[model samples]
Target: MTEQPRLTTREAAQRLGVKPETVYAYVSRGQLSSERAPGGRGSTFDAREVDALAGRGSRREPGTGGASGASGELSFRTGITLIDKDRYYFRGVDAVELATAYGFEDVAEWVWTGEPAHGSRFTAPQQFLDAARLAVDALPVHSSSMDRLRVAAVATAAADPLRFDLDPSAVLACGRMLIPTLVGALPTVGQHRSGEGRLARQLWQRLTSQLPDEASIRLLDTALALLIDHDLAASTLAARIAASARAHPYAVVSAGLGVLEGPLHGAASGLAHRTLAEVLERGGAAPVVADHLRSGRRVPGLGHRLYPGEDPRATALFALLGAIPQAADALAAARDVVDTTARHTALHANVDLALAVMSVAFGMPAEAGETVFAVARTAGWLAHALEEYAERPLRMRPSGHYTGPRPPRPLPA
Candidate 1:
């Protein structure tokens, strides 16, 4: 039997006239189904599905949960997070309210376990922290935080004797330790302090070169909470694909980290940061946006396909940052970027804009936004992992159509 040829994600995205992330969004919304590409590094879509979605208008409303892809129908069910009417929800709770009212630990519990905000304490064994530090330090000095994070994940998994304990309670226990241990092992820019109050505070120490006040801390906390989950992104889907194979929690997260490194995914924040910084240096948003247009490049950070208008997460975080005096210039620049882009294109300020503003306000690196996104989205990844673990294994394999030149006429036998 001849194997059907599959389309790489980029090919599928091209056929659909959408970006790769939009392909993932279509998968999340049940407009498509993806299978693990060989070696489990990424995903491949059914060529027939792409052809079908291309034939039909795959550009349905973003939040609606039905479309016609392969197999003549598509629908996905998830209890984790929802993006509808330009707002985000966890289960049924308002994400903006959760961001304002609780820390990331509490938000993680809510997103992962669907329990009310119970304020559960996240604790890690001392030995795990020690091992994670060694693992992190083994990376090259130029490595990004996500690079170190991937290393730490594998090392932690190797150290855990019960990593394959697929029981719900056991998996949740592993998640609790994974988040804190990953955060604590990284080198800090500020003076090291022992025993932080919340996950956000500890993460703030790792990210910024200076001490932070309550307002900045709250802003960071809101950023983390807001990023906890977003339906099923590429990273989340990768995590779920690993989980469907019954891979351990750490392996699941490693899969997510690998996918998140894509520039179109989590690392997009870095590009957005660069854009905002250029806007600031050029003295206004108009010039930078003009340069982007003249270069025939899409303006980074100002648009998202998922949101009909401004991304709600960016809107909420920008509103919070407007309260901080230090954030005034960054906030104004972001607004100008948004307004300028809107005048020329259909783009609006997305979460990447908010992340750039946060990094600028707090004196962090360009990639700091990606780091924050990685940590916060870990919760969502674990949640999706659990959901996939409950389903049958290898559930996402996409069948393809053969499109080669008629088997090469027997290949010159």
Candidate 2:
């Protein structure tokens, strides 16, 4: 096959967050069928094949069990995952401190490659800059910066011969490099890469263009830190699955981006933002929210799969938004929602509500919420990809489909 193809078993395994044997299992389930390799001891698969197995894609229902093996509940797991019932961390370090104290470019490097602060001493290469610039310039007007990212990933992979290192430090560098180049291309704004500004700050500034001072930058910075990584979430699983196949960090991140694009994980901020906008626009938040509850509507941004009582990040952010006039209504709604939901289910607000609160406080346009999340979560994406590079098996397995009537097509059909 002359196609250079998309991915392989080991690679797909990384994204699936399963053992290589599991990938084979998936193949057996017909969730993922194997493609022929030249000499055939094992079958090769592509990113799309695994994507199809995700239960949202083509092969989805297969006569039963929608999206199995996810193990659903966010419980204790096999890896050393750091959780934040209230505060985010990297192993043990407080993420808020890192976001506040460190430069975003530095933070991006740390997350992508897991290098210590000292490692960013080297600058991004010129060849990378030139190619990244061209990629940015060539992007079509129809695509958002997020879509442009797909093109950028392809370009970056082809331009850099050294893009495949799985070492923590190596992938970290890729993350730092990738975010800046991509954000630099967004429309109605420009990414600041020089003279005292960092990439994270630049992204924040662009996304929150309607905000005041450096406060939005600081808030965005911490948000990114807190969100950078959290073990094997579905999207992170996608990145890891790509990496285990020996694909480079860029490819892993790209696969992860695909998962992030899915509504289940990354689109909450936008959804919450839209809801709050309506509540705020309709006069009083409390009454409107009360009406929603009376109508049996579930409020967005009020719950999490993990933290039941409270999301620490949400708490911190809510506190920050309390004094801002623009955010007052959303903040008030959050308070009532918390009070109402608190008495019923143990569920309290998560980062989504707080983000909506901040979006209003910072005076950012409603659409900015999604972009802000994508910016911050990019850190987490890089971290997950690095994990793929460093871990073993690094493969995703799925059962195969035996759909086409086994032996023959009877020639004339």
Candidate 3:
């Protein structure tokens, strides 16, 4: 059969009177879908999709105006991260570049303070770690990693006498200590690494018992750094709201953790992990994808609403994963899933798929991705909270429009 013609990203952008980056933005927002070009160097768009979106005329960019709803227009000026076109940046530097070039501790410090501190390490104080571990150990044996994380946050907060201090420097210190504490509190799966080194090394011990090579450790570090921030995710918004209320840094993280429990958010990676495992077990992507569709479930680990094309983070991680020999089969399974689904939908792989590849390849649990997400994103939540603390307290309050009966009506009988 003759292959249908596809437009390159640049061609699609030109056709739509937008920049290539905007073309990617359209994919991220689900305004468009993208497929991999031959040789897999760039994305190609369905000519029809691009022309159809063009026919709709130029729409206002997201965050430019509020939609009609009970929640009025809300926007905030942030210097931390910007999601543009198909790539994202932290303080105007490419996030993928930053993540790949530095350790998770360095990248996270840069995200929070705008300067990368080389060789920086986060160490959880013994007292705080003790308190957090106690809390985590008290949970039911079956409690998820996220559950342990939440309890640890509260316990850590209680152990700090100055958690009420909202000073910028004080808050930053709290962040430095809190992140390591969260990681240290999780029950280890194999050998226990000392708590005095790189955050990723400590986290590796907790996730799996397999001895990791340099490449595997590098992959894990990059994943954490890449996930450190995304502009105004649901959990970030919640953390900002908590910061606006002058909540302490620990409380702010707790607030973000609360929102991460929803299946649509942090849990998405676990779903993707299960999906990739199924594809591997079933020996093909076709049946797995078919089973999901037949069950009326959208396939996980594909298509992100924010990038109409490839998710840049996924692109970067996948590139790194390709170098690890242990990752070959799982990575192939991920590609199979993407290729299989692409036959029907133009959706490309997202970070969850890459993360699932890591989890499945390393023999980690389904929920390992959630743990990585929550711990890595703690840095971002704190960064947003730092921004919010500088703004006027309570500035996030949006007035609600009354949608019920008139206020003048008497109380119900």
Query: For model 3, how does the per-residue alpha-carbon lDDT over 1-413 read when each residue is reduced to its tens digit?
Result: 67659999889878877678778877765667788989989999988777766654433243432221112124667899999989999999999999999999999889989976899988799999999999999999999999999999999999999999988899889988999999999988877556357888889988998877789889999999999999989999999999989999999999999999899999999999999999889998999999888898999999988899999999999999999989999999999999999998899999999999999999999999999999999999999988889888886554332346666888779
lDDT of each: 0.84, 0.63, 0.88
TM-score of 3: 0.82
Summed backbone clashes in each candidate are: 1, 35, 7
Write candidate 2's Cα lDDT for 5-52 as tens digits.
756778777767666777887666556677877676667886765765
lDDT for 93 in candidate 3 is 96
Position 396, candidate 3: lDDT: 57
* Best-matching candidate per lDDT: 3
- Which lDDT value does model 1 have at 110? 89
Residue 332 of model 2, lDDT score: 80
Provide the lDDT at 156 for model 2: 71
List of clashing residue pairs for candidate 3: 21-85, 27-307, 27-308, 28-305, 28-306, 28-307, 28-308
Q: For each candidate, give its TM-score against the true structure.
A: 0.82, 0.70, 0.82
- How many pairs in model 2 have backbone atoms within 3 A of each other, for residues 3 or more apart or on separate chains, i.e. clashes? 35
